[model samples]
Target: MSRWFRVGALASVAFVLVVLGAALRPLVLPEAHTAASILNAVEIGFAQDMAAHHQQALIMVQRLDRGVDPTVLRLAQQLSDAQRIEIGTMLGWLRLADASPLSAHPMAWMHTDAATSQHHSNTSHANSDAMPGMATTAELDALAAARGHNAETLFLQLMFRHHQGGLAMARVADELLTSGPVKETARSMFQSQSQEAGVISVLLTQLGGQAPH
Candidate 1:
């Protein structure tokens, strides 16, 4: 009799819990299973193109094969590290959104149309450059041929301009991307890159070099 009573009590508790779960399922399920927001063109474009942009930077920074001032070396190392991490972050967002990592036309998302594109200050990005502050193959070749101070100077100029261009992209991303992770990453980039640009400016002056026109 005692065993039967215990079994009956356990069954009754399980039945009540199941009933309670069914009653609350409607209230709890939707949010629990909510889908991630789809990443729009701007989000996808920024991720794809910016990853390429940073990859170029990584390439140039690595080209400083010869020794440089401690400061220059440290700056290049730090910038490259940050760029690598951010590239990874962008790629991660793209993966989550199930989007491609490369945009064939690159800046297609930055253009509304020819006339409308002119209204955008950064529309030069639509040209053959693919991105602002991107060093051409010729320029990268020049940088690779340089050594010591010349290489350091050229790298400084290139990276400073690159960061400036990246800041423009980050501003656009912060404005246009709806994804929280995308915007948050852009905002953080805006903050850090601005500060790094200031450091670059100081370094350039200390090196007796000026930004490329």
Candidate 2:
């Protein structure tokens, strides 16, 4: 597609971020301590990391070819739109918690594995680009340069793997968070991404492309 479409989508996303910020401002208590107490490290970290993860999905969408099959384009658009709104929501939560939107230790909040702390310690310096389901700079570059059926197959494959990784984090969040808006959101993400991943798999198969390992 033309650069104009990408610019317009980004512009819309910025407006959404503004609206979400406004809506969440009232949720912050006058006392920063109270706000901090309400949101624990796990909640804050999940929001931070997931927002970054969702941003990548938008990048993939923006990089997609303009002349791909309508089915692929429509799915990409729908997923991107949903994830963009989710990114706004997550950033709003970070604002309420007075936490940085960027995670210093990506995936460190996940305590599912016994070696999680050790994993964080070992990978701390390089964790920024190491989040689950994140595309490498090379992979994104390839996606940006690809066109037509090649782009469609690659997008579906990459996105399928991306969704799998995201769903893993969501499941962990849902398991760890007892009750709260974040947990509810995590559960919602898990459900939605699961369904979306299944559709992506079907589409990838129809395109004669195997899901990436």
Which one is best on TM-score? Answer: 2
Writing each residue's lDDT as its tens digit, candidate 1 over 92-206 gives 9889888888887776665554423432564345453357778888888998888888988999998888888787778777766665777888889989999998898888998
lDDT of 2 by residue, 1-213 (tens): 779999999999999999998888778535345333758888998899899999999999999998999999999999999998999999998887778999987877875463354334433234533677778899999999999999999999989989987887787788788999999999999999999999999999999999866
Best by lDDT: 2
Backbone clashes in candidate 2 total: 0
lDDT of 1: 0.81
Residue pairs clashing, model 2: none
Whole-model Cα lDDT of every candidate shown, in order: 0.81, 0.85
Report the poorest 10 consecutive residues by lDDT, candidate 2: 117-126
Model 2 C-alpha RMSD vs. true structure (Å) is 18.2
**CA lDDT of 165 in candidate 1?**
78
Which residue runs does candidate 2 get wrong by more than 4 Å?
Answer: 1-36, 112-129
Assess the local accuracy of residue 12 in candidate 1 as a C-alpha lDDT between 0 and 100. 100
